[model samples]
Target chain A: MQKVVRMDDMNGVASGFPKTAGAQAVVEITDLSLVYQTADHPVTALANVNLTINKGDFVSFIGPSGCGKTTLMRVVADLEHPTAGTALVNGGSPEQARRDRAYGYVFQAPTLYPWRSVARNVMLPLEIMGLPKADQRERARAALELVGLTGFERKYPWQLSGGMQQRVSIARALSFDPDLLLMDEPFGALDEITRDRLNDELLSLWKKTHKTVIFVTHSISEAVYLSTKIVIMSARPGRIIDIIDSPLPRDRSAETRDSQAFLDVAHRVRQGLLAGHGKDD
Target chain B: MARMIRPPAILTRALPLLFVLAVLAVAWLGGAVWLNAPQIIDRWQRDGKTDYSTGELVTAAWSQERPLLPAPQQIYADLAKSFSGRLDSPRNLLFHTWVTGSAMASGFGLGVLLGGILALGIVHVRTLEKSLMPWVIASQTVPILAIAPMIVVVLGNIGLTGLLPKAVIAMYLCFFPITIGLVKGLRSPDPLQLDLMRTYSASPIQLFWKLRWPAAMPFLFTSLKVAISIALVGAIVGELPTGAQAGLGARLLAGSYYGQTIQIWSALVVSAVLGMGLVGLIGLVERITLRYQAVPKAAGGRG
Candidate 1:
């Protein structure tokens, strides 16, 4: 079913962001590696990962478990430090971009404050940013409307279903509208039907705002279905294995899934994942 | 099919309570007969009275000037009389209750505030939680009643008299639970939310006011309920050894010195009411504040 696409989606999300994110690179990483120091042993979460995400790109990072897709997103979001090489967001260090509020991150879990209503959850970032109460309320309403949750603004997070709670978190991430949007397996926990529906809504959102999105997922079909560009990573000393350029049309749908070109990209992703698992054994 | 023979809902609840009250009344009467019987018999023989029956002896046991255990009605009558009299009357339990209530409320208020401050420190600083939590718990282990005289004496010497001294004792009793509950509550936010806060690059104070503090509300109220009850106990204990002036504790002391068992019982009942009122007040506030977040499900797990 076609979800209602709002005229002004995620009002706060695009406020100060470059409208078209269409010129130059939004994210640039070169030979990036991360080593997590544990007491027993140092484990490499990501190694020698190189990529460039342009403005308005919907890039999906797909790999087997233990691959550093999440770690890469965290690097871009400035949540974790890389051990080697350089990662730049909006042409500056990740720390600098984070301070600039250049990006918003959505975790795998909904991460909505249970005590807060849906609108209040969306208002959290704006509250931290010290926006006026009136502006915060306005932006929250617009963001919730973008996610088709206008009527449920006053409902607490627990009162909503899992999918609705996830949408609320999406509204929250976009409440402050940043140039970059990082999602780490946001729909991984949802059932197939809900996931498909959300995938369509997300694509429509991306289409509307043209925000630079870095989505991480395990499903091959999901990556092929949503991404303009697909990044495949390998496990065990996690490293970028291949970068596949998706030939799927911009408006990829159920028909796109049955299309030969879409199947070609999905098969390639599956093979890339199988190769990563092969190295594991 | 035959319909189920379920009792009416009101009857189902009230019947059990009525039965329990009946059993307690019967046991209390039997105890009165057993203990007061000796005295009534002694008087009968001493007066050379003749033809005293079991029924006469039972009726005689009911109205002693100072019975070993006063009947429930005797205590109730004393409470009614004490409550009905003038506000300034020394015999009035309600006035004594107010004297205690002032100290309890003040101490409870101060304790909750201090505990919240200490909890904020404990939650933010890792070393503080390790260093201070042990001491906070240890302070409770040293019974407040045992230390009440010392606190009152030291404060009294320093010119901290009356309500202030009793309030200090209440604070000593009240703060531990608030501190512990708040610490647990402040740290209760899911790790994912913490990471989200980090992503926002939110300042420590911002994080506290928005995330940590609000999340800690339910736990704070729960702890406050417990603390308020104990705070009343602390107020009474503070009054026990200090000057014996104008509190339920003082009333109890006066009654004990003058051999007024009925007076002591009335004081005890009034204090119980005060504790319940304080806890009920907290519960009402909790309901009002947390009204939005109530989910209709039984909490299936502890912690």
Candidate 2:
């Protein structure tokens, strides 16, 4: 099922043409590497990783577990520091970008405070940003409405379904209206049906907001369906094995998964993953 | 199949508690009889009464003046007498309760303040966690009974008599639990949540007020329940060493000196009820403050 598309040569850099002609680069990484100094030995999480994500791009970092996909995203978010090289977010250092509130991060779990109501939880980032009280409420309302959680404002996190809770977290991430969104397997914990529904919703939300999203996931079909550019990585001194620029149309729906182009991209992703594992042996 | 009629929820919850209390009351009655019997038998022999039946002896045992162990009813009667008088009078149990309760309230307030500050320091500063935590634990290890008298004597020598000295003793006993609990509570937010806060570029003060403080509420209430009970104990003990007038501890001392077992039991019972009331009050406040947290199970009905 795999198509014979030319793969970008692995020269420690994967640069794709911006979809929109004058789009500026949102994230730029240059030979970035991170080594965790454990008690026994140093564990290499990311090695000589170089990539550029442009504005309005839905980039998915897909790999096996312990492949530094999440670690790479964390490095870009300034949640973790690289031991070597550098990462620039919005043309500034990741730390500076973070201090300017350039991005919002959604963890695998919802991480909503149990004590706060749905609206209040969404307002949390805005509150910390020192937005006016009325502005916080208005923005939270709009964010919740964007995620189709309009009537559930007063409900607590525990009262919502797992899928609904994840949506609320998405709304929370969008509440501050940051230019970048770093999502670490936000729907990884949901069932397959819920995951599929959320994938469609996320695509529409991305189209509406035009935000640059760096999503980390282990699922090949998900990465193929949602992302414009897919970064495939390998473990054991984690590094990118292949970068594929998807040829799928901009607008996607549930029926898009059955198209030949979708299957072709997915098959190439599977091949890239196998190639990464083959190096491990 | 016939439908079974389930009991009301309140009654179902109360049944086990009622059973336990009934068993305790029966055991207490039996203990009173057993302890008072020997003394009553000696009294009968000294009075030269030869034909007293077992039934009469049992009744006499329960009713004797200055009995070794007062019957539950005698203590109840004493409590009734204390309550029937003017509430502000020295003879009233309420008067003594007020004295002890005031000291407990002040001490609990002081303990909460000190504990909150210490917890904030420990959570923020690594040095405080390493250097001061051991000392906080060591302070609790010194028995309150041993130190209460000294605190009272020292504070009294400096002219800080009355409720303040007793409150200091109470504060000393209560602060440890609150400090430990608040520390755990303040740090209760998971790493992911803290990282989320960092992504927002939240300042330390903002993080504390918005995230850490709210997260610590449930833990604070739990520790307060424990702290308040111990504070009452500290206040009562503080009263004992000083022979202070007008407190429950003083009433206990007077009862013991005069061989008034009923009076002693009455004071003990009042103190026990007061402790329960304090804990119950804290629980009520917790329910109100944490109403959003009631549905622990995701499947439960919404608030």
Candidate 3:
């Protein structure tokens, strides 16, 4: 198994990423834990988590529903604070990084304002960043075209299908050209066909932009297919159970799903998930 | 074929209302005859004309000098007579309508502005929402009719007469609905939308003008529709207790003093028409404001 996992150019190294000099590791989390105080009892969403995500990596967090995958993403996005330990983005606090517009977030839902046109929705972050109107228009148009929504620029979110809405949202997240993109179950609400198509497009998008993407999802296949590194988590005081770095080649087609290496990785992920469920049972 | 045969959208909306109006006209004419017939017969009997027939009785009732319930035609005729006169003449309905309409318009504008500001504060400040919202709700529960006289007297004591007092009343009545609707509207953005804004490092001001306020447009306009109609009512009500010698309320009072039921009915109808116009004006503004929000229907656009 170790022989099967070939560490290519050492760029895909997870834990030792930051310690290596001059590496462009975008996120560094060390023993980070978050305890949410509910009305009745305190719930631990994440416990003793450590991970390093390099620039241009497609990282996926896969776990059960109550697991802290989304929580971890939220922490990195500066939407939530940790209960203990240090988490940094671009060598600074998440709060400072957020203020610097270091990342774009795509929620589980499309989350586009129904009142805004698609171009206007994509221009939202740009507008907030005080980009001039002409620049906003140009960047927004380019992002929409990248997501295959060029002609739908003037259409409202409600006018688009669910899959199309998600694509528009992706366009919105990319419009400002943030270095890091955080997505929490973005394709969770989509149909299998749409999700599959988006997954392919998202890969292409990642290739073109070379942006670091931290994706949270429940689908094992989705996590395995898209991720260079897959972090498996468990619920009830959620913690990272395993981190499987993909040994698959850089250029992967749909037929890659049937490859022995792909099956081996998927089988390992399934085992990790089953091992997680076994603890609860 | 289907496209050519289909009716205009406006006509489709107007048809039901036109049918209702036709039914109402028939009812109003029938009711006027039924209600005033006996009074007509009694007056004729007093005049030694006891041999009057039912048709004559109805005609006389419809054409009465002072009817119990004025016939619709009489009111229309009175409106025509008043409206056709000089604009400045007291006899002209437009003269009095202008007086009331101006006060209502001023009040509506002020109410919307104040309501929008209050909603902004309430949405931004959780403490204000927790404290001030209950009072706003409580303020509306107090009946306007019961409070109108008191408000009039107090404002009069301060030497604030004429349009100011009426406009204040309009402001009072109109603000609550706008505030409530706006508060709900300004916060209408889903958690995800709000989170997205936060990710962009959007300032509170940007969050409002860009995201929250735009989302609240539909709610704000809906509340304005309710507010404008009531603001007009408020201006008219302000006229009543103050006993001003102008406006629709003043017209009603003068007609009542002379026992001219037709005049009173005409004044009431005129005021209703004015209310519709005010509401229609607001609706037009709302359409212009939200025009850009209309879904693009290009052939290639996704459904």
Candidate 4:
């Protein structure tokens, strides 16, 4: 696996930051487990999950439905609480990190306020953070441009295509310039062609911004294409089965997916998923 | 090739309503003649006039001094007379409308304020939603007609006479829909959207003003349309128990006492017109407020 030296890690290492400070890691999970108390019985959503996501790493959690891939991301976002062990974001508790606005979260749906225009939608978090009007407008403009939605600022969400709306949501998540991004199946609702295009766009965006991302998806190809690290999870008391660090170069294009190394990593991922399913069967 | 000419949108929209009105007018004229003919025939028979044509009987029925059901022309003439006089004159239907309309307006204002407060309380506080919502629902079940007189008498005893009592009754009727609509509206945002707001670390007030309030605009307007019409009804009902000298309710009372059915019909027409005007006003405001919403279908109902 080719290890890329990120800017934050270089700064941490140069500054002699202690390993106990979790300087290089954007997220650290240790034996994390979550149980949902249902009417009939307690359902374990996550089981003894251990993972570390480093700075500027594009991490994808790939698993089937009912898997705790989304749940583990939720724990990092403080949207869900773990029943056992710890999940940390930016060297602090998830709740504290959330309050500090350390991350931007993109949900399954666009979740744009229909009342607000595209620009205003992007500016929402900025507004909540009490950014000045001029600063908000400037940041919103820059963010919209980043997602290739510069001219669509005045248009409403409904006016846009499904793919465009998802892009706008990505712009919104980026508007605040959070150190980390959490995306939960953002392009799952889009058509296949749109999904492929967005996947490429997402990779380029990740490269340009160098922000750590924790993406949850069910598509193995998407996971293999976009991620530097792939976390495979299992269902019915979901747990991590494998973590594959990609050997692909730091820069990749559409042609990269056809390469032998890409297929090898994808094959390993498929095998891991089948192995997880075999345990349940 | 000749281009096909289509009716303007306004005309097309109004055509159905115009057709319905024409049908109603024809039915109303026929009903008037049918209802008044018997009285005319009885009078002619009592006078020992054996030679009477059906056409003459119909003409006499249409022109009766005190017909059971006044003709449309009679009501129109009465309305024209009331409108021609000074607006402040007690005999003018506009004056009565003004008195009732003002009371209704004041009550509607108060109702909106009270409803907004109650909805805010109920939406933000779980205990208020559980404890107060049932009482709020139960409050509406008690018939307004049965309680109007007592309200008037009780308030009169406390030196809150005339407009205040009537306004209170109007407020009582109008507030229920607003509260219910607003409560539903405030809670209408998708759970995912709420989670998005949580991610932003938005305060409770921000969650309301930025998301919930805007989402609830459609519901609030729909409720207002219902509330305004009912507020007018409340104002009239409030007037009935008091027997005060001014207002549509009083006009109906006086007309009945004098057996002037034309006057009664005219007052009823005025009240109907007033209700339409109020609802139309609300529709106008709703359009202006919710212009950003994508489609009218999106705001179709409480959903």
Pairs clashing within candidate 2: none
Off by over 4 Å in 1: A1-23, B5-62, B298-303
User: Model 2's CAPRI class?
Assistant: medium
Better of 1 and 2 by lDDT: 2
Question: Candidate 2's residue-wise lDDT over A1-281, tens digit each?
Answer: 01101111222234444344565778877778999999999999999887878888899999999999999999999999999977888878999999999998999999999999999999999988889999999999999999999999999998899999999999999999999999999999999999999999999999999999999999999999999999999999899888888899989988889999999999999999999998888
Clashes of 2: 0
DockQ of 1: 0.58
Q: Once superposed on the true structure, which residue ranges of model 3 sit more than 4 Å away at CA?
A: A1-23, B1-15, B292-303
**Total colliding residue pairs, candidate 1:** 2
Show model 2 residue runs off by greater than 4 Å: A1-21, B1-10, B296-303
- Candidate that beats the other on DockQ, 3 or 4, i.e. the better one: 4
DockQ (CA atoms), all models = 0.58, 0.75, 0.58, 0.60
lDDT of prediction 1: 0.87
Per-residue CA lDDT of candidate 4, range B1-303, in tens?
999898887898799999999999989889988899988878888999879887888788888989998889989999998999998999899999999999999999999999999999999899999999998899899999999999999999999997999999999999999999999999999989999998888999899899999999999999999999999999999998897689998998888999999999999999999999889999999888877775647756537
lDDT of 1 at A57: 84
User: Mind giving the per-residue lDDT tens digits that candidate 4 earns over A87-112?
Assistant: 77887899999899999999999999
Query: What's the CA error at residue B1 for candidate 4, in Å?
Result: 16
The Cα RMSD in angstroms, rounded to one decimal, for candidate 3 relative to the true structure is: 4.6
Report the candidate with higher lDDT, 1 versus 4. Answer: 4
Candidate-wise lDDT, in order: 0.87, 0.90, 0.87, 0.90
Who is ahead in DockQ, 2 or 4? Answer: 2
Estimated TM-score for each candidate: 0.90, 0.95, 0.92, 0.93
